[model samples]
Target: MNPTPTYRDVATVGIGGPVGSGKTSLLSELVPRLREEGLEVGVIANDILTQEDANRLRERFAGVVPEDLVAGVETGACPHTGIREDPSMNLQQIDAFLAEYPGLDLVLVESGGDNLAATFNPELADYWLYVISVAEGDDIPRKRGPGVVDCDLLVINKTDLAPYVGADLEVMTRDAREVRDGPFVLTNCKAIDGIEAVHEHIVEGVLFA
Candidate 1:
């Protein structure tokens, strides 16, 4: 039987993407910013083999995002199946977080950035952001993966490399817009560009109303 869950004011948000698409880096950036704004944030990192992402986040976040706020799940090779097909482990981690940090304002559930086929269970988050990278190729948006089409917000990251990589930022975003039928954003997380737009969108779209 599962242990009693700890309760918190956490609003869960799921972040998913393909490998090298910058989900962890984005978390490294977001955790501190959220704290600066006085929002309590927790995170659950789901990985296929080990707690690598959780440890990376703990080391990277340092003092901002608490050590306990990050939990890791072993997906046993099928990462998407862990988060989407069977999320019992994920739920347990979340319950544990809420039990510990009762005042937590948000929980960022990060899937092991795998492929375009990955997405989160609605049961896991009030909202979810699916990330893609400009370096992955411009046609990714046109592929219409459930991740691209169904996520509440689609984040096109690594925009700073667009020119070098021959990725068409405008067209990629246009295709994302056409497919998502929701907001699409461009971010250069490495350069810290356009992140405020993400923050603002979050506040308005999920945090407030």
Candidate 2:
């Protein structure tokens, strides 16, 4: 028999995107900002066959939150299974975090690298953000994959790399607006530029609004 879950008091947010889209980098920026707002947060990093991403986050969030609250789920296949088709593993991790940190107010679940079709199951996430890199090209939004079209918020990251990568930020913005009914933000996560907008969106979308 399974144990009762103790995480009902916590809100779960899922972050997903294609490989190299800076999903982890965004988390490195996001977690700290949420903490500053005085929220107790936990994080789960999902990866294919390795705990590398979880290890990275544990180190990144050291001292801010308990290390046990940061965990890695190894999917061993397409990243989407543990988040979309089936989320039992992710759910179990959330329960573990809550058992340790009952006051946790929010949990961020980071999916492993995936293609444009990746999306979170509503059963797993109360809210979800899909990230894509401007370096991936301005044409990305034009693709209009379910991941981009269905996410609560679409984040265009690494905006600073647009120049070297030959991506037109204006065109990306236009196409994103044309394709998505939801809000989108352009971010240079490393510099922490535009992060506040992302934080505000979460606050309004889930925390308070």
lDDT of 2 by residue, 1-209 (tens): 86666556689999999999999999998899899999989999999899999999999899987798899999988999999998989988898887778888999999999999999998789999999998787899999999999999999999999999999999999999999999999999878899999999988888975
Whose TM-score is greatest here? 2
- Residue 10, model 1, lDDT: 59
Candidate 1, residue 148: lDDT = 89
Relative to the true structure, candidate 2 reaches a TM of 0.96
- Candidate 1 lDDT, 3-90, residue by residue in tens: 5444234577888999899888888877788899998888888888888888988898788777888778888877787678877778
The residue pairs that clash in candidate 1, if any, are: 6-98, 6-99
Cα miss at 123, model 2 (Å)? Answer: 0.8
Worst 10 residues of 2 by lDDT: 1-10
Count of clashing pairs, candidate 1? 2
Which parts of model 2 are misplaced by more than 4 Å? 1-4
Best by lDDT: 2
